[model samples]
Target: MTAPGLFVSFEGIDGSGKSTQARLLAETLRARDRDVVLTREPGGSPGAEEIRALVLQGDPDRWSAQTELLLFTAARRDHLERTIRPALAAGRIVICDRFADSTRMYQGLSRGDLRPAVDQLHDLMIGTEPDLTFLIDMDPGQGLARAKSRATAEERFEDFGLDLQTRMRAGFLALAREFPDRIRVIDGNRAKAAVAADVLAVLEAELS
Candidate 1:
């Protein structure tokens, strides 16, 4: 029988080092001779990348919460169809930097009332969830500092200020609780190597 594909996702607030950790995990798994596909949401596929520019650029309010949700779901659908699903079907390990969880956190915070819309849309259009999700948890202050240091046009989301980041951190923690089976919270305030080590430990436990 063909073995099922492994789908892993890394999630965290801006500057929580999720992207770096995701890359490290991908490299480590590859070193072990595993078929790994390291990708990111909102832009994993060509069409999704185009949507990424639209959603991540411009002013913070460039798109309303509802509109942004639609755009994100669109991108996610494309990414899944063009990149994620294909890799998974081939029995490759797929590691995504961010996934639908991000849309839930961001849009849910933008307008607390939009949380339902986000969840409902996800259920309808994006039925798949990650097999494992690593949430790099950290203080919003520290995370904002890290994010500001590497500011770019994509600052639209990061520009939401410290309060929003703090709230989003809470949102993520709540999500971890809600999906305890799939979400693993990692302390991200440590050194990169240390954090990556913890990430590997957690992932290895799952794999083994």
Candidate 2:
């Protein structure tokens, strides 16, 4: 009988190494002869990718926090229908670079006032959450520096500055408290290999 699919998500402040860790985990799982799908939001699917450009590009103020939340929710819905759900049904281990938690932190703390709305929208639309979430915890200063080191057009969220990133880190931590059973906080300030190993250990415990 085919085993049930496992859904894992990597989340943290921008530049917290979640992306790298997500990729590394996927590689490790595949090396173990597991059928794995490494995907990311808000561009996991074709329709979501189209929305990704709109939300990640242009001026930082291109959309209000509420509007941005809606866009993300729309992209997430599409990603689920077209990419995530299908892969999970096929019994593939789905590793997502950033899932709904990102929206909660980015929009929730960035605007403070919009957090309730973000939660409401999420509950109403994108209800599926990852089975395991790795919150790559790190200092906002270091994280922002790392994020800025990368030259990418998707600077809309990265452009929020250090102050916001600081709050985002705190927000993510608080969020971790809310989902202790599913969200594991990993120290991301360590070397890449070290963080990857820690992530792998967590996966080994949960997935094995």
Candidate 3:
């Protein structure tokens, strides 16, 4: 594997607007002449995207605990090899929409013990570490309400009630505790511009 490059990932529940923030960050980086590559997990590569469809299409609650772990790992393996690795090798700033933490939280929803294994896999596949990982935190109920209003499509995980999402939100907070250096938690209850500004503050401190 190549040496590490500047990598950052945005993580949060379904409706925390991770993608929106990621795009804003990417554009800002580009404006500053930083080579930036924006990608997302469970769907970064072609193979991984197919895995995403499978994982998200079914009732996530019904998917066996082990099945959930394997599917996410499978997608992650492909994503790391195909998308994240190359971009970083080129010295690009990779702003990913979501990464291993998503799996840790979602898998935790099913089986808590799967965390150690996921962490190990994450260490293996994630060749580069984010200088900063903005974790958008939101109340599960509010996020789910927003998610329901925005997405017209159906997915297994999308059908989960607010309770599950709430648990997942807590899981993310716990993850930040586990990796304080890389993870920066952002309150997602605020306005979009406010959230964006908060993220930029961290980036400024890091890049300058």
Candidate 4:
């Protein structure tokens, strides 16, 4: 039987390599004969997936900051009930691509409080934080350029504009500051293999 497991998250601005490292880590763990659940926020489950599409489908001209926050929170609640809580209870290591911190960075900081109603929306969702978070950090321009290089098309978050993304990157680092022990900052500009190795080292440490 699987023993009690750990909850870990990878987060960052777009193209900071959160998803790639998360998947790589999961695969590595599986290779080592450990049960690893790889998942993402705002779409880990059916209800959440719908919300995710709303959040990332288009540009800022279509979705407002507050709207994006609500969708994220909505999907998060679904993720909490459908994926995270269940996997943890079943004793499976859970590595999420993004979590509450993403919201705090994308919505909390970039949006500038979002005209007050956003606070209420956040309260309605954005539940407990992760047990451990790997903040894959890099320069905003570098991150965005990486994203563009890898992507065939842009998403809503991608079209958030440069200044907004810079603020979001700062926001992520600031959030990482609040939970120093829980959040580990990784140099995302490193080679993917090097970054994956760093993630593996951190996970091994966390697990041990």
Compared with the true structure, all predictions reach lDDT values of 0.91, 0.89, 0.81, 0.81
* Candidate 3 pairs with clashing backbones: 7-130, 58-156
Over all chains combined, what TM-score does candidate 3 have?
0.90
Worst 10 residues of 2 by lDDT: 1-10
Q: What is the TM-score of each candidate against the true structure?
A: 0.97, 0.96, 0.90, 0.90
lDDT of 1 by residue, 1-48 (tens): 114789999999899999999999999989999999999988999999
- Residue 145 displacement in candidate 2 (angstroms): 0.9
Lowest-sum lDDT 10-residue window in model 4: 114-123
Residue range 1-208, candidate 2, lDDT tens digits:
1247889999999899999999998888889899999999888999999999999988888998888888999999999999888898988899999999989888766765777888888888877889999999999999999998998998888887998899889999999999999999999999999999999999889856
132-162, model 3: which lDDT tens digit per residue?
Answer: 7899999888888888887654456658678
User: For model 1, what is the error of residue 172's alpha carbon versus the real structure, in angstroms, after optimal superposition?
Assistant: 0.3
**Highest TM-score: which candidate?**
1
- Each candidate's root-mean-square deviation in Å? 1.6, 1.8, 2.3, 2.7
Would you give me the overall lDDT of model 3?
0.81
Candidate 1: the clashing residue pairs are none
* lDDT at position 62, candidate 1: 86
